[model samples]
Target: MVKLRLKRYGRKGQVTYRIVAMNNLSRRDGKAIEELGFYNPRTNESSLNVANIKRRIEQGAQPTNTVRYILAKANVL
Candidate 1:
C-alpha cells in the first residue's frame, strides 16, 4: 500500500517535514516515491504540488491524518 505521509528532516528541536508518497511499510524518513510538498511547523508554512497530490490521491494514496488537516487548511481537500 502507498501512503501520503511526512518525512522528517532538519536538526533537533527544529525539525521540518517533507510531504512524500511512500510505501506503507517503509520506515519514517526512508526513501520516498515522490516528494509532493513540505511543511515547516516552526513557521506554520507549507508548500504543495497540488496537481500531483490530487493525482496521487486519485490513484489510491491515502494521506495521513496530519496531512489531511494540512490539505484542508490549504483548501485542497
Candidate 2:
C-alpha cells in the first residue's frame, strides 16, 4: 500500500518534517515517490501542495494519523 506520511529531518531537538508519499513498507527516511509539503512544530508553520495532496488521496494514498490532522487543518480533507 502507498501512504502519505511524515519523513523526519532537521537537527535533534529542532525537528522538521517533510510530507511524503511512499510505499508502506519503506523505511521512514527512505526514498519517497513525491514530496507534498513541510511542517515545523517549533514555529507551527506549514506549507502544502494542496492540489497534489488531494490528487494523491483520491488516487488511494492513505495519510498517517498525524498527516491526516495536518490535512484536516489545511481543509484538504
Among these predictions, the greatest TM-score belongs to 1
Candidate 1 lDDT trough over 10 residues, lowest sum = 68-77
Candidate 1 C-alpha lDDT tens digits along 8-54:
99999999999999999999989999999999999999999999999
Model 1, backbone clash pairs (residues 3+ apart or across chains), number: 0
Give lDDT: candidate 1, residue 64. 98
Scored by lDDT, the top model is 1
TM-scores of all predicted structures: 0.98, 0.97
In model 1, where do residues sit more than 4 Å from their true spots?
none
Per-residue CA lDDT of model 2 for 1-77, tens digit only, reads 99999999999999999999999999999999999999998998999999999999999999999999999988889
Candidate 2 regions with alpha-carbon error over 4 angstroms: none
Model 1 Cα RMSD, 1 decimal: 0.4
